[model samples]
Target: METVVMRVEELQLGKIVAEDIFANTQYPIIYKNAKIIHEHFRIFEMFNLKEILIYKEKKLEVLTEKQIEVETTIIKLSNYTSFETDYYDAIAQIKREFGNWQAGAKIDITKVRGMIIPLIEKVLEDRSYIFDLNSYSNAKDYLFHHCIATGLIASIISKKLGHDRGTIIQVAIAGMLADSGMAKVAPRIRDKQSALTEIEFAEVRQHPYYSYLLVKDLPALKEVMKVAIYQHHERLNGSGYPKGEKMSSITNFAQIIAVADVFHAMISERLYRLKQSPFKVIEMIKEEEFGKFDAQVVQALVDIVVDLPIGTKIELSNLELGEVMFINKYAPTRPLVKLINSGDIIDLAANRNFYISRVITKEY
Candidate 1:
């Protein structure tokens, strides 16, 4: 009998592999034509097995579950599909409340916090899909894309740092509301076309302080809420405002929020500036601003961005178009690509090889 196996993405469409049916009885099935899809299907079925063998090419052995827990965490991120509408409404409401906090009486920070926690857990359960911040739009949609993105990043970082559930939630909540003050800023300044003057910048910096004040009076929110509101802007270099806090003074929870905030801001398209490419932003964070961010946290973000599937169409450097096929973790900017019209994957990581030169520009 011919052995059959399916790809991970195909599992969602109900694809089946007849020959691999018997393999299901065993833990960690191996197949010559195995795909990550089989492992995902197994996960969807809630099978508590580890590892799946996809295929072996020359010296390369494709094992699907080395970091099984991490991979599983990534796969569960798809749950956001169900909560998109709720997220959208939550953001819209938050934005509106910021515009006129009195219009809605008092903003229900506790209620909003409750709604977002589960979403964060879902993303934590599946880190892979959720970490693909580049593919998501950061527009002014009512959806919780930003919250979800921040939550995912926070969860990943929290897990890496061995943070407990309570700590993780605190970080996630901070991430969700990091921009709550944006609503308080004048609409024109928030939506300005050109760079802001020193005054405008100062006003923007006041957001974190304003957010802190907004929640300072709530007893239930005294602990977690204040952290989220205040620390989102405190940076490592003491350059961040409201307070010029250095890394030593910054809380770990606050640091996580800062990374999430910066990452989301870079990937998201704003009214004044076009979105910065994820890989490019990662590189920038690593170089001149090295100590400004936690090195491990930045690496986690880079790993997530570099591993995006090859068939994903992306706007590239010099206005050329290509689809990512393979990622060079060491050099994310130069991933292997297959031109839109071409059929082969070009490994840009190969030095002086016939690969597309330059990085993916932010013009798109």
Candidate 2:
């Protein structure tokens, strides 16, 4: 029988695989001639497999009609909401849920999945949304916004790290809920505008444990996800809270959320602290905070920020406008830039006093 290459998104139910599919495992993930089932979609996404060979159906007439429907879903971009709208709406939902949690309500996992899954899908569609997460945040709604953005950031980082779609979504959820335990803390402590007292700080640090309690009984959540929620605050160097877990004890999933949580928290504005530039914050995470995080997870975030295309407009720490002219392989963050006003090319690697403050425009 003749076979045709099909995009994984276009593959219909019951289609026969034309060849074995391997995702670097010792054995094939999907055997040749096996029928495609609903579960296989996740396997394909997990492996990031774009296209696969499938035997042509005996009835070409029915196949064409089915393929058209699949193609329509694939090509349609209008179905999704704008990233910002979906994002803020999710924040609002999380705010409500946090209130519910404070009122002694049980977690409604279905509702969380509904609000977050779309935001994740939209963000995954346009990876640039990750860059602007900090700008969308405010001090008043910082906690709510952080939860949603952390989930989105975690999802993208997980994707970059080559995790399956399901696992990526789980990591996003875990990252968002990592701080949910704060709802269990005293309101005065959580809402305090000034510095937290050492006693208050100690109580606040138990949020991760509270978070684990909130979701421990959830059957929909995997056991590893529950552990990640509890361990998101746990650092690789054993400096983190709840439990002082070292490198060997921490799970990769927890580390993904940990990096995402810190990245969003530092770049975002809060009552007690000023928001730092994303570029500057990333530098601190990679250098100053090096030993506390997983190297692979930190590198994934670095690649997302530093691997910018030339001609991307940006602002420097000195309030000067410029566009990226070239990227230095060694110091990806410190690229050569052309000053928008002065028309002079300065290599940021050599110019230690200046650094990227924010990306103005991504388009060339």
Candidate 3:
């Protein structure tokens, strides 16, 4: 029988696997010709069995035995510990403060360090586990995700520079609270989809200063913590807001937060525009704003996203579905992909026969 390849999108849920869909995971032949209505499906759940052999032909053909590999790769990638229970609790408290910022409820700046430090240590220890906050689909979840991502990135940088644990935690807290001033802005203005007028942009730029002023007088959070609220927006080229201080004047802690903040914002889908894919965003950072960010820090981030695992589903330039099987670490934009229907894994990095035109959707 001539082998026929089918895209996962083209295959129905009930369609029997003409061949072993994968070595470890397999589906029953009864699903042959079954239509798939949803874009996302758990292969294990759909099979109703842990593993089975599947054939790709029109009829059922058991090719080989299979096993379901239970691995918490994502969870294990980050060094999660039960010790951070209090940290998680602190974030919930901070979120509550954000809800009542208008009623004169102040964010507990001292408590911020406790929650942010361990998260940063985890990010530094295991680069793979830094969740991309910008990848979230819902705008309502952005605030929490942003805080997490920021803390993770900041902590990684601090550890790289050999900062002590106490100092690293303080810096991470700064990164987490960098955008606290946004709470003061009206939801309508912050969530507007259209281009902001000059007045609006000015108001947006004042958030860092406003945040600094709000907590600058607190004795517990007087000096170091203020950096988190004030200097986050400052850039090395003096293009950033408030005082327009040059890069030399910004603290190393603040610089790390700035990089993380910009990265999260660029990749995150926003009301005003679609989010850029991780590779594309990294490219823009390297080409257009290299001077604005620490080169070592940016390179570390680039390395993390470029080497994401194979079998990861991604949106392609043609609005088709595919999985990453290989990556050209040197040129991350061009990666080897296996088209869902074709099951043909093409190595764009080597074949030179095809090119990845563009990225349609990012892998979360």
Evaluated with TM-score, which candidate comes out highest? 2
Model 1 agreement with the true structure over 200-305: per-residue lDDT tens digits: 9889888787666666666655475477568777778877767788876777677777787777767677655666666667666778567777676677666655
Give the C-alpha lDDT of model 3: 0.61
Ranking by TM-score: 2, 1, 3
lDDT per residue as tens, model 3, 1-364 = 3435555444434334434233221222224333322211344333333433333555544222221122112223323343245335655766776787656777765556566655565565555544434443346556666776676677766666677877777667777777878788777767677888888888888889867766776665538658756988877888877888786688766777887787777777666567666666777899999677767777766666565444566655456677765455556665667788877655555555444433333334
Task: Flag the better candidate by TM-score, 1 or 3.
Answer: 1
Alpha-carbon local distance difference test for all models: 0.58, 0.83, 0.61
Backbone clashes in each candidate structure, one number apiece?
15, 0, 26
Instruction: Assess candidate 1 and give its TM-score to the true structure.
Output: 0.65
What lDDT score is found at residue 159 in candidate 3?
67
The residue-by-residue lDDT of candidate 2 on 224-304, one tens digit each, is 999999999999889997889898899998999999999999999899787778888888998899799989999999987
Model 1: which ten-residue window has the lowest total lDDT?
21-30
RMSD of each: 10.1, 11.7, 12.9
Q: What stretches of model 3 exceed 4 Å from their correct place?
A: 1-93, 110-126, 135-137, 160-162, 186-188, 191-193, 217-225, 307-329, 332-364
